[model samples]
Every structure is written in C-alpha cells, then in structure tokens.
Target: MLFDLTDLRLFIHIAESGSLTRAAERMHLSLGAASNRVKELESRFGMRLLYRENKGVQLSPAGEALLIHAQQFMQQLERMKSDMQQFSSGIKGHIRIFANTTAVTEFMPQVLGSFLARHPQVNVALEERLNADIVRGVAEGTADIGIAAGPVQGQGLEIINFSTDRLVLVTPREHALAGSGRIAFADTLAYAHVGLHEGSSLWHFLSRIVSQSGQRLELRIRVRSFEAMCLMIEADVGIGILPQSAALRHSQTMGLALVELDDPWAVRERSIVVQSLDALPHYARELVEEIRAGQAPRAISPDRNA
Candidate 1:
C-alpha cells in the first residue's frame, strides 16, 4: 500500500521479463534483493501475485491488475519529472502524443515544427493511430495528448476544437465525376478506386462506406501516402477519396480535380483531448497551445482555438 516508486518500477520490470533473475539483472539488483522486494510486495498485498514454475514467473489475477495500474503510474511519474524540470533554466521536457492519420498527415507537421522552433528544449514522440485508439490511449494515460477526428465520448476529457478534416473525391481533370461538383459515396462504387494502405484510417473509413453502399468499389491500386494516391488517380489508375487539404494542395500542381462528397460523414472535425489541461506539465501546456494555434478552422465551434 505504501510502496515507493522503486518498488512499483521493479515489479513492472519483473512482470515484463517474467523472471526474477532476468528482472534483477535488468534493474542492476541482485537476485536475492529482487526476490525480497517481490516478497515484501506480496506481503503488502497479502496475496501471491505471481506463480513461478519451469519456464518463468507468471502473474495471477492480482498481478495482472497491478501491472495495468503500475504502467499508468510510470507514465504519470515521467510526466511529473518532465514538468518539474521546466522550473529549471532550460525547458528539457518530452511530451508523447497519439494522433489519428488526418492529424498527423494534414496538421501536425507545421504545428510541431513551429513549437520546436520556439521551445528548443522540448521534444515530442508522436504515433499515428486510429481515432478510437487515440481516445483510449489518452484516457488510459498511454500518452499525454490525443488528436482525433469526429465526435469523441471523452468520458471527462477536455475536448478542444482542432480542425475540420474534409474527405473529397479526387479524379483526373477529364473524368466524368470530376466536374459533377458533388456526388454521393455510393455513386463512386461503379468506378475503380486508388486506395490507401489497409491499416490506414482513411482506407478503413472508405472500406466501410463502400461496403455499406452494397456495391463493389473496384480496387485498382493501393498507396501509402495521400500524395501517392493522388498521383495514381492522376495517372488514371482510379479515383480516390482524399483529405481536402492534401488533395487541394496536390491538385493544383498536378492539375487534378476535386469534387465534394454528398455524405455528411465525409466532412469530419478534429479535437484535442486531455484529461486536465491544468494538470499538464508546463512545457506540455505550451505544446498544446502551439497545436491549438495551428487550427485552420473550416467551421465554427464553441471552443475553437485562438
């Protein structure tokens, strides 16, 4: 109950390694010391959290629950250390961010670039995840911040308006759908499509829409980036549903065309999620502000960024 940070850390190390000896070596502690520390924890809990046998140590139900909370504890401790360092001369803080593909591709580059320019001592680790995973990760303390598109049932998170992500139909300049101005997602089913990678959020979203349309969306090619998808579309491989910001930027240079999507879901809004802004480390707060400043708002919202 009154375990120090070291106890929690060592237990986590042991849980990860699944062996007392290996964990002791990793922690630079003797096997006897590690064994004693684990015994003390078992005494505190009044239960055996781990079962040892031939291969390695395995967690009981209690150990499994403790591992979850212990990981969260480590994340918070790291954030606390980063926050405290801000009080010293230089910033020297690291903020971890998990964001969906739209945020990473269309928004974060310039925002993070400007933030790093202003705060040289701060660093960031960013991962592109699905919108659902982004929400869950931030809520579970896996990351300090989350950038996701569409409405989030944040449970008590502070949701700040980030940006509007529009999905438009991109095609060659002479394609029939190119000059249609706006078209339903289902209408595109008859034509071949240049799709993003299978794991990408856009690809999943498009796949679902195409499935729901009850018509086959002929797949011509798959590319990793929006630019690549656009290039393939330009070469007449097929049409693609791409982010408006990306499609517009490349369409101008490649002389491609953009058509509005008739479905309401095609236009998505993004938001920044945090458990508590007031509780964030100072440098993290600054980083949030930097991202907020990059909000290229295409619509009005109650808490739009300044």
Candidate 2:
C-alpha cells in the first residue's frame, strides 16, 4: 500500500501525544477519524503500531520506525517549501559563499550580517578556504560566490575588486629591525619567523614568495592566528607578517613594532570571483550586488575579464 505525507504526520502526532483524542484536537480531526487513520495504518502494515496500556499508548517496534521516517519526511518538506518560496517573493533562499581567511575573519562577517538583517528569509553557508581552493570552488559550482586575497590564480572567472589589505612585518619593539621604516620581504626572511600553521594560505603564500626570491625563510615556529602569532612575537620568539590592521592594532597593545614591506606584492588587492554573475539565481545575485555595494569606489573590483 502507498503511504502519503498525511498518514506519516498523523502517525507522528499520535505517537507523541500517546492519545488519539489529543492528537485529533491538534490535527483538528475528530477522535474517530484519528483512531480510524491509525487502524488503517496498522492494518496495512499487518502489525500493531501502538500498544495501549493504562498509562498511555506506546509505539510498537514498527511505529518507532515509522516515526523516524516521518520526522525525516517533515524536514525534507520544510526544505522544499523554503526553496519553492524563493521564486515568488524571495521569502527564502540559501547561498553558498567561499572566502579566504582574511576575508572570512575580517570583512565578510560584517557584510553578511548586514545582508541577513535586510533579508531575513535568506541564509548563507560560508566556508574559509585558500584563494586557489576558492577559485576552484567557484568554477566547479561548489560555491555560488567567492572572496579571495591577492593574485587569485585562475582564469575564466568573472572577478570584481573586493577589498585591499597589506601584509606588514611585525617585530618586538626592542628588536634590532624594529626601527626599520620600510624593508623588503626578502630582507625580513633573513630573521627567524613565527607564522601560522603550515596549511594556512598566508604561510603558503610567504613560502612561495621566499622560494621565488631564491631565499629560504627561517621559519622557527607555527601558531594558529594573528593574535597568537603576536603573543609569540611578544615573547621574542621571532618576527612575522600580518595584515596591516591586525599588525598595527596588536602592536599597540603588545608593544610590538610594525614595518612596511617594500615588496610590490606586500599590498594585497582582493577580488570577488564567480563563474558567471549572469548565471547566478536571483537571490544569489542579490547577495552579490549587496557585497559590491559595500565596497568603496577604489575597492570595487575592476572587471578582470576586461
């Protein structure tokens, strides 16, 4: 016999209330109709679904299984309804957004929060990934939108200027290089460096820079975050590089010193990447436009394709 959603829902209601009378009131069905529905389900299954006792009714093994399936069915229906409503009034939507560490930790939060405030029915699931990974995600349709740091390494993607940040060298205030106003990244590599874990994009990016310069970075240790790296630097562990804002703020509190890097690549220009803006759904495009709106004129990504 074919079972319908109403059968499952009524079964769940009865299973929870343990009384047909109460379940009927909740479903607005008469007690007789509720009882008959349960009997029909039990007869079709060829087994008793509920065991009636003095205290209340309890699920038989078969009813327990049905309840599990019913809950899952209800959840799927909710998702279907939510997705369906987007077309008519944009009452609900889900967007897949990917970004690098800097964008995710610093800027994306505020931008997403503001967007969510304006569109309560829309939901976003964001992931922090390396720029390379983000590029791949956008191209392969794994992510609807991507925010990546400088020198994003793929073509065929529609790119827009997202934001700008600089990587500044941080050192102990009394360290020998502390007084240096501006230095090259290659020069900073001469000192033992405290950095993020090996897997982090910043670490990998720095490693690539040192490799390209034909010099070896003296990486002494790896920590988790900019603040943690700052703490290690405060202990005189080693020098490090961080975003300008993060470096300056932490240096003020921790007595660390910041130096501007002379390398042309030290200043990072981030971009928002998508396989094709025109291919995005209406709600996804809304999200993309909001992100574009938040950026200043200089930060607005240039048409990389142009």
Candidate 3:
C-alpha cells in the first residue's frame, strides 16, 4: 500500500532498463521525482531494493521479489479489464488474432466483416504469423486467438478444427512441369520459384521445408498476394506453392496450372487455437464462432498422413 501503481510501474521500467534516467523518461517523470519515489518505497519497506552502479542499477533480493509480484499484478489487471469490457458499452472490446497466411489471405476477410458488423463496438487486430509464432503468442496470452494449419501439439491449449485445405504447386501452362500431374515438394525446389514475401507465414513454412530437405529455393521474385504470385507465374517468372483454393480461383483467369503436391504436409487442417474458449470475453468468443461458421467443406486426401 505504500507504493502506488505509478510507483510500481516506474520501478518496473527502471528494473527492466537498468537506468533511473531511462525509467524517468519512460514514466514521464523528472530524475529527482523518480529518485524520491524510489527512496520513499525503500523507506516504507526499510530495505534497500536496488544497488546503484556507475553504469546502471541492479536489483537487490528485495527488488527481485517485488518485480515478480509487480509483473503478476500487471498481468492480472489486464485480464480483469478484458473480462469487464463486454459489460461496458462505452468501452471498445479488443481481440488480437494471429493466423497463418492461408487464413489471413483466403478466409478471414469475409468472416471478419460479418463479425465486425455484428459487434460494432469491438476492435480486431489480425496478424499473419508462422505456426510456431502463433502457438507461442496464444500460449503467452499475447494473442487472444490463433489460426494455424497442419498438426499442432495442444499442450495446455485447446485446438478446434475449423477447415481443411491443400497446398498445390502452380506453374505456367507451358512450363515443363505443368503436365507432371503431381510432384513432390522437394522436386519443385529444382525449378525457380515465385515465393511469398519473407514475412509471410507461408514463406516461413516453405523455407523450413526446404531447409529440412537440404535444398534451397531458387526464388525469382517475391510477392505479397496469391493473385500477384499467380500473375508472375502466368508471366513465366517462376513456379510457386499456394493454397489450392487460391490457386483454383486464379487459374480460371490466369494461365496457371494447379498440380497436387505429393507431400503429406501439403494437406493442412486449419484449426482455431486458444488457451481456453470459456476464458475469452463474449466479443472474442463471438468472433471465434464466426470463423467456425465460415468453415470450408472438408476435403478427402489420398495421403493417410494428411
């Protein structure tokens, strides 16, 4: 009770930055004011919390103990606010979702529009991230929900199967491998590829596969959208791997051939991931239901491993 939220926050900043000057700047307080606050905290507790050094400050045993409690308190405060948001019409509820490229580019727009229309007071932040990053974000409570594809270990989390899709190789109509019918992903690495931008989840997935195969992708160009990649392929820039849904849609207008990938990993089961559905606020839960409602019809794959 001796230190207020502002004092605790300032202490956290100083502990993290290891500099009172930097902490003062972060807390928007003068150096003297920040020093007095720390002094008062120590005076109330009758213990030295930090050891001052020429360069910066180091936490004493007491300071470390306080830091742990302070961090937990801040996290609980955030959770409390989120839980209380649905009851307050004046406050806007916020949801953060991390998803794979396929979900972000192919499915989310339509579902999100409907969800936003229903919840006008709610805000959504959707970001594309790799499977690992998405899982980590959800686990760490950084993301309210995660949309991931393929097999996932549900350690301390809930996984809901939402849809299914396949990754297929796209090539120009006249390309040499266009008539192959189906090809292994490793074989495709022999040809030049039109890949997604490095930051895209699909790009990260493909790069990991290539690394595991001990081969490298001969990337001719990088694009941000499936349409762009298809256009590039039509222009004979290079071949590419794309979600079958996207490739099929583009093949109608572009000179692109969709060839099935002979790899088990190509057949992906898109899933909704969260720490716990019941723990989410009403608005966040509603968004999850919206995504589930937009599920694609399940596709049968020949590969048992799919």
Candidate 4:
C-alpha cells in the first residue's frame, strides 16, 4: 500500500527522537497534531508503528520493516534531487578527481579554488595516485576525471591537452651543479640521480630522454614520491629531476635548488582524461572546461626555449 511521504517523515522522526513531544518540537508541529498524524497513519495501515515503553518509543515488527523501506526511499529521493539540481545549475554535484602527486600538490589548488568559488554549490573530492592509477580510476568510473603529465592510452576516453610542465634538475644548495640555471642533457646524466621508481610516468619520461640522447642516467636511488626524492636530494644523497613546479614549491623548505633541463625532451604536456566528454555529469564537465580554459594563458610554446 502507498504511504504518504509526510507520514513517513513523522514516523521516522518519532522513531529517531523516541518521544512524540520531542518529534513534534523538532518538526515545528503541536504535540496534538503530531499524535493525530501518527494515529491516522496507523489507522490506514491497521498496525501500530510504535509501542510506548518506560524509557522511550519502540518500533513493532511492521514498523521496523516500513522504517527500512522509508529510509531507502528518502535516500533515493535526495540523490535524485541532487542530480536534478546539478543538471539545472551546472554546479551542484560531487566530482571525484584523480591526479598524480605533482598535479595534486602543484597545479590543482588554483583550478579548484576558482571552480569552487564560482560554483559554490559543487562539492569536489580529490584522490592522489600515480599517472597510470589516475587513468585507471577514470576508466573504471571510480573517479570522474584524471589529470597528469603525458598521454594516457586507453579506449573510450577523451584526452584533452590542458597544460605543460618542464622537468628540471634539483640539487642541494651545496652541490656544484646548484648554481647552473640550465644544464645540458649530458651534464644531468653525469650526476648520480634520485628518481621515481621504474614504470612511473616520470621515470618513463626520463628514460626516453636518456635513450634519445644515447646515454643512460646513473640512478643512485629510486623512491615512490616527489617529496621523498626531494628529501634525498636535500640530504645530498643524489641529484634528481622532477616537474619544475614541484621543485619551485619545495625549494625553500627543502633547501634544494632547481635548474632547467636543457634537454629538448624534458618538456611534458599535462592532460585531462575523461571516460566520455559527452557522458560526464554536468558538474564534472564544468570543472573540466574550467581547467582547460584556465591553462590557455599558460599554454606551452612549441619553441622549448620560450
């Protein structure tokens, strides 16, 4: 049998508060009105939903069953309302984004800050993962969008060029190479380097540069995160290569210095990956557009030196 939503709300409130008077106060209704509403609902269903006990109200067997269904129904209704508001307003839904550590720490703050300020109603959640994992999250629908450096190869996903970041060499302030504003590919390879673990996007990018230059880099240590690599460099364990933004952001606190990599291949493009551009929820699409447009002014020139 169909039940009125208002009656269900009153029943749930009474069940939650364990007192009819408390529920009436919460609902801004007189106690008599609340009692009459409950009585009418019970009469229609021909079953008592609550039993008065010494301490509080208790739900009967049928009340328990109806309560479960009512809660589920209310949750579904709330979800529907949220979805509809997002569709109509272009800004009122949860967007789950997966990004690499570099993007998460360096780039996303400005983009997200602006998006949130403009939308106000949108809620955003960010997950940090490696580049590959970010791509996987977007493909699997676990994340609404993925942002990272370099291209992601997968079917059924649209990759958009968002921005570009140069990979630079970082060294401790005391290192001989610290004063060099820009170092050639051969010079960087000559130093012992701290690098991301093999198979990471940064590692793969560095490998390509080494291969194209006909040399192999001497890696002193392999670590999982940019922060770890920076810590190692600061301790003078080894020099390292990382995104320029990461180097600049941590340079002061980490006691590290950054030098531009003169290698032509050191530049990398940051891209936004989505499962389907057209299929994204309204809020997600809006976020993607903001990121894309926000990078227009910072678009890397084809001339690497520029």
Q: Scored by CA lDDT, what does every candidate get?
A: 0.82, 0.79, 0.87, 0.79
Clashing pairs for model 4 are none
User: Residue 122 of candidate 1: its Cα lDDT?
Assistant: 83
Predicted candidate 2 versus true structure: per-residue lDDT over 1-306, tens digit per residue: 547777788888888888877888888888888788889888888899899788778999988998987887787687567667765676557888888766676667888888889878887888888788899888866678998878776679899886677888888878888877788888876799999987677878888888887888888899978889999998999999987766755665786877778888988887889988898888788878877777542211112101
User: Once superposed on the true structure, which residue ranges of model 3 sit more than 4 Å away at CA?
Assistant: 1-4, 7-18, 25-93, 281-283, 297-306
Query: What overall lDDT, based on C-alpha atoms, would model 2 receive against the true structure?
Result: 0.79
TM-score of each: 0.76, 0.64, 0.77, 0.56
Runs off by more than 4 Å, candidate 4: 1-92, 113-125, 130-133, 153-156, 197-200, 207-216, 222-224, 293-306
**Candidate RMSDs in order:** 5.7, 11.6, 5.1, 12.0
Better of 2 and 4 by TM-score: 2
Write model 1 residue lDDT over 52-128, tens digit each, in one string.
Answer: 88998999999999988888888878877767877485767778899877778887898888888987988788998
Q: If both were scored by TM-score, which would come out higher, candidate 2 or candidate 3?
A: 3
Model 2: CA > 4 A from native: 1-91, 293-306
Output the number of the TM-score-best candidate: 3
How well does candidate 4 match the true structure in TM-score terms? 0.56
How does residue 23 of candidate 2 score in lDDT? 81
